[model samples]
Target: MNQLGSIIFLIAIFLFSTFLNWYVFQAVKTLTFGLEGERMKQIVAVSYWLIFGGISIWLVITFLRIFQMGEINVQTQTALNVFLTVMVTQLVCVVFLFGEDIVRNVQAGVTYLVNGSNGFSFPERMRWVSGIALVVAMIPFSSFIYGVTKGKHNFKVHREIIYFDDLPDAFDGFTITQISDIHSGSFTNYDAVQKGIDLAIDQKSDLFVFTGDLVNHKAEEIDPMLDQFKKIKAPYGQFSILGNHDYGDYVSWSTKEAKEANFLKLKNQHKKLGYRLLLDENVVIEKDGQTIQLLGVENWGLGFKAKGDLEKALANTAASDFKILLSHDPSHWDEEVKKNMNKVHLTLSGHTHGMQFGIETPIIRWSPVQYRYPNWAGLAEENGRYLYVNRGFGFHAFSGRVGIWPEITVIELRKTVSSME
Candidate 1:
């Protein structure tokens, strides 16, 4: 257990390192690139850093307030702090979503500054111009919190023939809609969730898949929003696999037994929602005398995570068969699927959430999630294999989605005689 805690801390640093690097680069660019492109880049770069850094900083602050404001003992304070931190984070997740507009405006500023630069390299003149523009851009920066609170969730839908393999006659053109990380307690608006679910349902999916982190930390966080989630039903049934959050792995727990008990309870609740919980296991869906093997592993990855054994899950399979894997993290695509595993045609995952913030554009400036996952927010295929990383169905610590709106991915698997050459 101590080893796991150390591992998580290290992974957090590793992931956060990208954010740190991005910000430092922007700060230097803002200081050096006295041109419009540089200035605009500066705004965008700062905005991106602030959004990622701000939430984390706030979470730390919340933890302190929850335990420090009153006269609580060290042990009691620790428990309360963990609970309140998760709760409050769940309550105001929209702030994180709101960072999108800030990114958009900053991206726009990048364009403006690029033109404004006019190629003047005098340090004294450059400082004056950048300082003023940076101040003006702060207007949008300050307003970003408001935009997130204002209840806006925007997204783009990208679907394609990422992986093409032969399917049995019964399941040609089989469409599977998968979504995950619906941290319901954090969402401010239920309607946005409904819209995403509606989009998935529109695909007439044969199977509806949900990777975990359905609620903040407890079932009650989402009890009020079941109506929205319940809307995600399909012909092949809604199936789910757990993520790290689903296992209650984020906090300091009193007893290992209690934590494991909570996980079991959450798993049971999922069953009540009409979902087949696939924990380190596989199930075969038969059609037209052909079998499509669906293998789901527990939350396994390169660190101190849950036990997700893919080989064990697919041990009984014959050498050749149509296969699809459901492992939440895309890292699994690298760690497991791309290795000794069979020619798994299509692998579906959603741990990224795009982190819920994508890239910035003129018409669309959004999240930094793209920089994190190469196969980050959409369908990606390479080397005769494919992976669809769903942006996510719900928000995380912040309630809303900015440029990276929550996603409902409808992936259609078709039999192709022609190779993807």
Candidate 2:
């Protein structure tokens, strides 16, 4: 964005954040109003402002550094994470506090209307209401803290068995393990990341695919953990495709040639890890004299990059053949993949990371990202086509995974008995 637009955006964010802080501060004052001593009240007030002001200043400095230098260090990322966690906690407290104020004012107004203004007084803030607000706010605050400390590396293996009527007989019961969004630059704990890689290795799937975002903005990010990821090998082969971030588009470079060189280096990293990096291309995996097509396209999504050529990727492939597509963003499946004339039996993607935060249980699955991408996580099917979106292998901007932990997806493709008959 231009300089003036950026300034306006920053001002808007500052005003909104200021409003939230003021609202939460009022609740804090109400909660401590009945304290025993003047000194105690002074202490409480000072502590609250000190903590909030410190985080706010840190965030402002971090953002300014990012704007000027086009870089974010580990310390800056940590500050951003802390600011988001605290802001979310304060928002929860503000909800309850606002409700209490509305009810109290309404009651006071009714009393004044019924009686006269003589010796009338507004209702004092209730300690019980403020107490409840503070207590409830702890739930999210604690959850966010744990998410940063542990949840990012807490990988969960999700398994799905999809039955396809047109699947080749030889490939029946074939398992493909998929992992996406490795975001290697954000990793801080090497041992924890190694454990996640070991879990994927244990799955023992026939084929393995990495759907993208191997690095955050540069290829060198994967240098430290290259060996760990190389351990994920399957019997058939390991394949990969790029995500939007792989092109180094997020960072500002000194020259166009520098960016292109970085992109070339990233592709070479995939080969170093023993993966066949597919760039709008197809390769056939053969078993028992029968072949199934595996097509991979570049990063293509509705709002993001559109480098993937679906038609070119499907070139020379028949409609009747069993085909599996590897695209990074799930929107490709929703917008183009499923609707293509040359049908793809299955499409694997992983870009949302389920927003790295949301509630998912046996009963309800909900994330804010769902509003943006209909097929945000897990499996979604339409007619005979299937799409499985891996939650992600790592975290990004937020530096944490709350309820939506990092994921390794294992999919077993089965051919239906009816199709054989």
Candidate 3:
């Protein structure tokens, strides 16, 4: 479905939540405000109210994701920032205004009942009802359409080093260009895709890595951009891994063999494009008169992602070598690489894509996925280990980004210095 259609479905959820909350609210009010079993009513009422609204909102958001649009350029996002700013600001203001009145009415309802019981006047009840009316009037503003696409191809040289103490000294100063979640099915237009690939090529990094989800579902989704992806080059080589979406898990197919064939075809296609497909295996990049083991594990994640064995892939290795692991999901860095396999020092991952949406500001930066993981965006460090989550080279199901634009990340690896504190 299209973005507008998915948004309409969310509106349906909003309506359902409204009805459920109202029905439950009325039932509770009657029990509490009258001579009835108020305690039982409170339990059931609270359950219905919270569950209905929360679940509905979640479902609506998830469903609306099917409309993921093409990414816009950074220039475009900045150009439209002024107008989008006004729209988002005014819309949020209106939503909050009604939200305030809703709170006032609830408080007033309790106030009126308490006063009436104590022999005071009932005049305040009308005010409570009027406040409720105002709250109801503000729902449309809360449903405003935000400027979702923050755009993709803005190039600023970020001279940052993503380092790890355990990194092999031989591989220090290694620069790499990484792409993940291209999802070309949703990437609309030749110009945008070309621009994104051009940015990656312009980095001129030693090695290039593609983490996964190259297409949304089938192989055909990416055929249009095959030549563009082949253009990405590095002195060392290019490597890739599979993402959960690449397995054709989300769609219904004629047969399992056909789906498997499609995935294998994609793997072969990667080979045709001069990328080494890493399927639960490892590759050694010989550079700078030394070799560093590049261990590429299959798809794996903490909760939502599929599991692929990283240990089996690294079984032949010595713990002392400088190692860089390419695992699709960043959550793997926290759950597995950080502890169970501490030997894997520098890990590169991209399943999160910062959840494809994050706050784009200097102060108090954040993304919605922040609720899911502590180290949710940009570069993350813990326990002398390093994980860099790419924002992504392509767009996905949401069709547009608000603050978080689609990204092309260039990372330079530096060796740990010898100076003492």
Which is the leading candidate under lDDT? 2
Model 2 misplaced stretches (Cα beyond 4 Å):
419-421
Could you give the candidate ranking by TM-score, starting with the highest? 2, 3, 1
User: Model 1, 371-395: lDDT tens per residue?
Assistant: 6555676666666777777877765
Clashing pairs in model 2?
none
- List the RMSD of every prediction in angstroms: 11.4, 1.5, 10.4
Q: Write the per-residue lDDT of candidate 3 for residues 1-421, one digit (tens) a residue.
A: 4557766876875675565445434423533454457687677767865665555555455444433422233333332333333333333434444455577677767877777556543222233443453354344223213424324333223335876665666678889888888877776567767877888889999999898888777777778888988999999999998887777766657888988898888777778778888888888888767777888887897775556788877877787777778888888888888785537767777766666545667786877687887766567767676777776666555555555566677788887676793
lDDT of 2 by residue, 366-393 (tens): 9989999999999999978999999999
2 or 3, greater by TM-score: 2
- Give the backbone clash total of model 1: 15
> What lDDT is obtained when candidate 1 is compared to the true structure?
0.63
Candidate 1 vs 3: which has more TM-score: 3
lDDT for predicted candidate 2 compared with the true structure: 0.91
Best by TM-score: 2
> For candidate 3, which ten residues in a row score worst on lDDT?
140-149
The local lDDT score (0 to 100) that residue 165 gets in candidate 3 is 64
Q: What lDDT does the true structure give each of the candidates?
A: 0.63, 0.91, 0.67
* TM values, all candidates: 0.68, 0.97, 0.71
